[model samples]
Target: MLLADFIRDGAARLEKLYPSPEARGLVLMLCRELLGVTNYTHVVEPRTAVPEERLPELEAALARLCAGEPIQYVLGVAEFCDRRFVVGPGVLVPRPETELLVAEAVRTLQEMELDRAPRVLDLCTGSGCIAWSIALDIRDAEVIGVDVSETALDYARKQFPQGPSFIQADVLDTEQAFPYGPFDLVVSNPPYVLERERTQMRPNVLDWEPDLALFVPDDDPLRFYRAVARWAQRFLRPGGVGLVEINEALGPETAEVFRAAGFKNVRNLPDFYQKDRFVRFQTPDNQAINN
Candidate 1:
């Protein structure tokens, strides 16, 4: 079949679930990954034929996409912080906005210029995107990632041949005396989406992404934030920075979780869209030091 014919037909099939532009984008991304074709390959060649031997496999993938599986899952990777991270049904696909948290981390660690190598702890480190991003950007960074899901930790550990270390532990259990600490930075992109917010999400997300990495009780949307606060309070070096991605609707409330934990300079940070998407805070400079 001609490449243009498949693109048009696949997009048309997807429009039953997505808008026109997004449907086309998904089809284009699929073509790029499987057929090694550019977005405009069909347009330029005008008669580029999809190799006959690849037809069945391509059709099977297109069927999966039509079944509402995330394009990233079908492709088996997601681009985050300019690097592709391994991903699948059991893990949350790395979102673009989480890169901002990495940027904030890189900047804060750079500004510290500590005499010793910087240590970082990433709670709820699905796919280890933030952890790996920091470890790669700041070569001397000692980055560790934590997640409760064995599936997530598997993907996180497999992200790179060598980078951050992955730990299998629930971040919500803040009382555990997890041995690695006195970190220079504590960062997380935890489950901030409230249970009530599920209705607003796309099927590919609500159905495909793991609930363990996405939802929180509506009555207590700040549960993860509170756990992060306690972890920061216990393990962060005096004046060490802590940042967490938050639900936009709870920006001030989430920031208060840190403040209530006795953190200093607790404040919300906005994403590129100026929505309050993260809370940046620090341990009190007077806090007794421990490594």
Candidate 2:
């Protein structure tokens, strides 16, 4: 079969099954992954033959795509903050909205104006997209990513050449102590979507992504926020900052939780869609001692 014929037929099958704007894009990406052919545009310009040996691989990938496995999982990598990281059913595929979370973090770090490398923590780190991005960008900073699942940490650990640390710990455990500071910054994109909302999500997400990394109990959607805020109060240094991605509908309640935790200068940052998507807070600066 030829390349143009392959994309056309695969796209048709995906459209019939998935029926979304992402369907064609997913098929094209799968083609690139399986065929090792980077210049797909030229194949579209004319017609080119796909090697006969490649047909079986393409067919298998298309079959998996039709079965509702996410394209990222099929491809074995997810792009976030303009970098690719390995991800699969055991981990949640990173989303564009979460980039807003990373942006808020970078902005907060810059505003703090520290002269030296800072200590940073990523809670519920998942595939470590946020933690890795910070370490790569800041260069001098020491980053630690913590999650409850060792399998998730394994993928994250493989991405870093040698700088960041990964810890496996439940965030809700009352006795746990964060090893890093009095961290200069604490950031996360913890599970905020209510379990009931699963019916409303796309199959690629609801079927393939890890539920533990995506949903929260409906009764207390802010459970992670509450735990993280309390943890930060204990571990974040004086004037240190905390940030998290949140459900837009919960902005007011999130603000209340942060305030009650004694975090000052609390504010919500909106995503590209103009929804309240993240919150930032800081500990109050200590008063100077007089002579």
Candidate 3:
């Protein structure tokens, strides 16, 4: 079949799930990956025909898109911090907003005047995007990522030949003994989506993304934030910064969790859209726990 016809038809089929422009973009992206066609291939070569042998492959993937699978999971990768990380079922696809959290982490690690190489701890490090981004950007940095999902740790450990080490551990169990510590920076993009908020999300996310990495009980939305605070308290160096992506509706409450955990200068930070999407906190300078 002609590439133009396929693009038009596949996009129409996907329109049931995505907006008109996004559906077209998804079809174009699929063509680029599978058929080696540019976004304007059909426009430039009106007679362009999808190779006969590859048509079946295109149809199978388009069927997944029509079924409401996320494009990242369909392609098995997500872009974050200007790098692609492998992602699929059992792991949450990295979001663009999470890139801001990585940027702050990279900058914080770069500016630190540490006696030794800076160490970083990434909690709920799905796909290891945050961990790998910070480690690759900074030379000789020691980074460790913690997540409970063995599947997520699998992807995290293999993001690159040489990057952060991934460990399977529950961040919620704050008392768990960790051999690594004194992190110069601690960051996370943990599950902060409230259960009630599920209705507000599109099926591509609510259905495809792993729930373990995306939500919390509506009555206890700040559960992960509290756990993140405790982890930072135990591992983060004195004066070290802690950052966590947060639910915008619970920004002030999320910041309070860190403050209540003895964090100093707890503050809410807005994303590009100016929503309070993250919380930044610091440990008191006078205390040191050299574990």
Candidate 4:
């Protein structure tokens, strides 16, 4: 089959779910990844043909896309912080916005005193994207990622041969004691989407992503933020910093959770979209602020 024809057909089938340009982009990406063809290959080489043996595989991938499976999950990888992280049915696909949380955490760690190796903790560390990103970017940084789901932990643990230590524990289990602590930084991108917000999400996410990693009760949408505060209080060192991605609608409420936990310098930070997407705070200490 001609490569152009395949892409045209795939994009048309995918248009039912995605916009025209986006559908075309998905088809292009699929071709690039699976066929090693550049996006402009079909346009520049109109006679390019997809090998007969690979046609079936391409068709299978297009079918999955047309059925509402996310491209990342279908490809079994999601790019975050310029690195690829494995993702699948049981694990949540990392989002582009979550990269902001990683950027903030990386900047905070770099600005702090590096007299000794910095310690970091990541709560509800689905796929360990943030945790691994920080560890890889910061030399000798001790990072630990905690998640309740064994499936998520498995994916997180395998992301790097020697990155953050991935542990299995519930973020909401206040009574459970974590063996490692006294971190210089605490970070999380926990479950902040309210159940009622499902109507606002796309079917690909609703049908494919892990619900355990994406949602909270509408009546208590701030539950994960409250849990993050508890983890920060217990694990973060004096004057240490904490950052977490949040639902834009509850920015102030989420920040209040950290402030009420006795953190100072609590503030909501905007993402690329300028939405109130993250909260950063400092654990109380008499030490002078490190500029």
Q: Roughly what TM-score does model 1 have, to 2 decimal places?
A: 0.98
Candidate 4, 167: how far from true, in Å? Answer: 0.6
* Model 1 lDDT tens row, 1-291: 999999999999999999999999999998999999999999999899999999898999999999999989998999998899999989999887899999999999999988989999999998999999999999988999999999999999998899899999988898897989889899999999989999999998988899999999999889898888888878898989999999999988888888778887889999989999999998878683332
Please list the C-alpha lDDT of all candidates, in the order they appear.
Answer: 0.91, 0.83, 0.88, 0.90
Runs off by more than 4 Å, candidate 3? 289-291
- On a 0 to 1 TM-score scale, where does candidate 3 land against the true structure? 0.97
Separately for all candidates shown, the number of backbone clashes (residues 3 or more apart, or on different chains) is 0, 0, 0, 0
With a 3 Å backbone cut-off (N, CA, C), the pairs that clash in candidate 1 are none
What order do you get sorting by lDDT, best first? 1, 4, 3, 2
The runs of at least 3 residues in candidate 2 whose Cα sits more than 4 Å from the true structure, single-residue gaps closed, are 36-45, 287-291
Best by TM-score: 1
What are the per-residue Cα lDDT tens digits for candidate 4 across 44-142?
999999999999998999999999999998888998999999998999999899988888898999899679999999999989999999999997999
Which ranges of candidate 4 are over 4 A from the true structure? 287-291
lDDT of 3 by residue, 175-284 (tens): 98898987889999999888888989998888888999998998888888888888888888788999899999998899989878888888998999999999999988
Query: Would you give me the overall lDDT of model 3?
Result: 0.88
Error of 4 at 207 (Å): 0.5
Model 1, global lDDT:
0.91
